[model samples]
Target: MSSSPQTGSEPVTAPSTTSLTLAIIVSCELMLMLDGTITNVALPMIGDGLGFTPAGLSWVTNAFLLAFGGLLLLGGRAGDILGRRRVFLVGIGLFTAASLLAGLAQTPWQLVVARAAQGAGAALAGPSTLALLTTSFTGEHRTKALGVYSSVTASAMTLGLILGGVITTLASWRWVLLINVPIGVLVLLLAPRHVAESPRHGGRFDLAGALTSAIGVVAVVYALVRTADHGWADPTTLVTLVAGAALLAGFVLVERRAAQPIMPLRLLAERTRAVGFAIMLLVPMVTMSFQFLVIQFLQLVLDLSPLQAGLAFLPMAAGLLVTSRTANGLLGRFGTKPTAAAGLLLLTAAAAWSATISTATTYLGGILGPMLLIGLALGLVIVPINVAIMSTVDPQDAGAASGVLQTTMMTGAALGIAVLSAIYAATVGSTSAVLVGDDAVALGMRHGFVASTVIAALALAVTLAGYAVRERQSSHTK
Candidate 1:
């Protein structure tokens, strides 16, 4: 919350000097990133194991996401106020403890509660990872380090699917949650030896901005979820949506007035950052919906086992790995703006292809094609947008700026999945019976996928328009 120097917002000009150290830090970061999506594939197993109702099971993901997204600013502020090294260890500690609790949960409620705690831990640790990177290296070295971070982030979704599939099939769903404990322990133990602390700054935390933003995101996401259950026309849904919008607006006002703002209004007002984050949000909205919808298609419609379904997503992981590695070089040649636009276009095309898929579609025909294209598009889009957002912000505010960048994507994906799930459910029929019955839901699921393509297409327009503006701005500067 505090815009202090000691919170480690100073830029990293020499990550090369500490390359080995940063490798360890990046591993720590990858662990956190892996946790975000790893549990996604394991959701079905966890629900069955805990005897959770369909609606009840959504909380396993939503609870963790809401807490993680809502509290990210607080986490970034903690890094600023508490000192990055101290806060990093604290976050690692909290997340590790929560992982153990989640692993041990015997009931559905217990699991949801534990997941939320784990989210709290994640929120704290996640921003610290970026802040640590900011202080760990500098200059062109910083760019390279960010590229490394970006690739890890790019592959996170697919990595989670692969890991969850193998682990859940080979071991138990609990192992998916339990996996974090060992990673966290390693990070907590090694963080101090490799990473140097940023010099401290003086200020109070932006408590007001943090609270309103968190509540606002919760309210909005809740409203989206309500739309699924009650339909979009329901009074409760409308009221929650209105309330969330109002609270988020108030959050803006609060940040404008606060001496130490968690999110700087000025940064958000930038055309590049705003557009970039919007594109960032939309990409996940498309992909996460694909995950929720398609996974069902795989298991129920295609009759694949959890392991098979998980393994089926391997192409996505492979595609991301190949494309993400070349992204920086692509960006260097094409420029950040054009590269982002191109990526969005590719993503929209992938969604278009994905929309054509159905329960009757073969793994090769329907699933693998979209998964690979989507993965490649993600590798292209995520890195540049993330780099743009973080790079545009003032170095002193990197923690808050990066926190918002990460939070928007996570919240959007979570809320996006919830809304998409409702759409699939209402249109396709209840998921429970589809598994046992004649599978009448395939038609509806196909329609849902097609409709989601509209979102990606719209995002493409936004990306194109934004980049055009950037091009004009560059021309003017010249």
Candidate 2:
């Protein structure tokens, strides 16, 4: 890892970055990822609080992602135009205030609105967190800083399940949302004193670029979700899908024309960046599909409780944490392509192994082994992909690059759940457990897991191409 750079700013020095500052950065990033999925576990309690229906429960999560994913490019632009530190503080303030409002919400809309507000804050600050670290350290030290940040983001979603389970179990569901207030306030206080303000890029706002990107993403996700209630052929669903695609295509054209695009076209055009984006998209696609399928296997087939269902994932989470620490050294020692390929290999193997699972199999022998491999391997893949995404980016466009990274991730999960869940439901022929026999449900889940394994293999193929092209290029350069 490289030491901190002397950028004529003493406060930006390595020594000035206290343990407190690191804690703040890590906490903030952790909360950002945590909020992305934490609400899933607390949905029952949230329903009780706000009187949500079974279908309405999903709105809590979708609301956040819609606003979060939609405005992410714009949020990154906001940080660039306004000031990273200033925008960060504003996001934290907004997030903390929204957390309070969400906790106190008496109606469904109030909670949904507050959650969307939180997502807006997340979109604003999430990009800047990485951008801030970019300016904070140089070379090797920068890599380590990024490694720490990357691990937290990768594992935070898993950690959220634990936090939400405990918080919702021990306290009221309101505590789930309220917990962010203290942590965010603490981070807000520590951020300014230690973190230096990056110089603002004085440029005109790319309004068309931002709207097209955000609207395009939301349209896609909303359409994907609509497939649950309306069949894939529904007119509303068709309109959303077409308009979303057209707007996204328009976004690409707008980026080429604009002087400063919300998404820099050149970044995506690079082979490495393109592969990284595809990895981001496909990894979540497979993982979310697996999650949807496996929960049914655990509860319907194996007869696990809601809490036990969540707990069944311990091996996956453990493997993820253990492997996240080792990824950096692997990437530092090996180039990005090899590292990513290994990760995709692990992921593919894990999912394919899961296809062997059946109703009579034991948890330890049947499930735990493959899940650990998936977690450990997934942990390894994230940093290499992040390295590739950030490496190709111009230093000036770091926030935009990071926003695009997140947008792909958010969109992928939504898409995965939609397509894979649809396949599962159609195959299973029943939505509710009481109506459908457990054996039939298990058969449907097996198909979904098998399909997910195939998706992972496709990702592996992409990584293999990455390996071949990158190595051939390296030899040519040498």
TM-score of every model? 0.91, 0.87
RMSD, one per candidate, in order? 3.6, 4.5
What is candidate 2's local distance difference test score? 0.73
User: What overall lDDT, based on C-alpha atoms, would model 1 receive against the true structure?
Assistant: 0.76
> What shift in Å separates residue 108 of candidate 1 from its native position after superposition?
2.0
* Consecutive 10-residue window with the lowest summed lDDT within model 1: 469-478
Give per-residue lDDT, candidate 1, residue 244. 88
In model 2, the clashing pairs are 1-140, 1-141, 2-140, 2-141
Q: Which 10 consecutive residues of model 2 have the lowest summed lDDT?
A: 469-478
Give me the runs in candidate 2 sitting further than 4 Å from their true place. Answer: 1-15, 44-57, 105-110, 292-307, 355-362, 424-444, 469-478
Which number leads on lDDT? 1
How well does candidate 1 match the true structure, expressed as C-alpha RMSD? 3.6
Clashes of each: 12, 4
Give all candidates' CA lDDT scores.
Answer: 0.76, 0.73
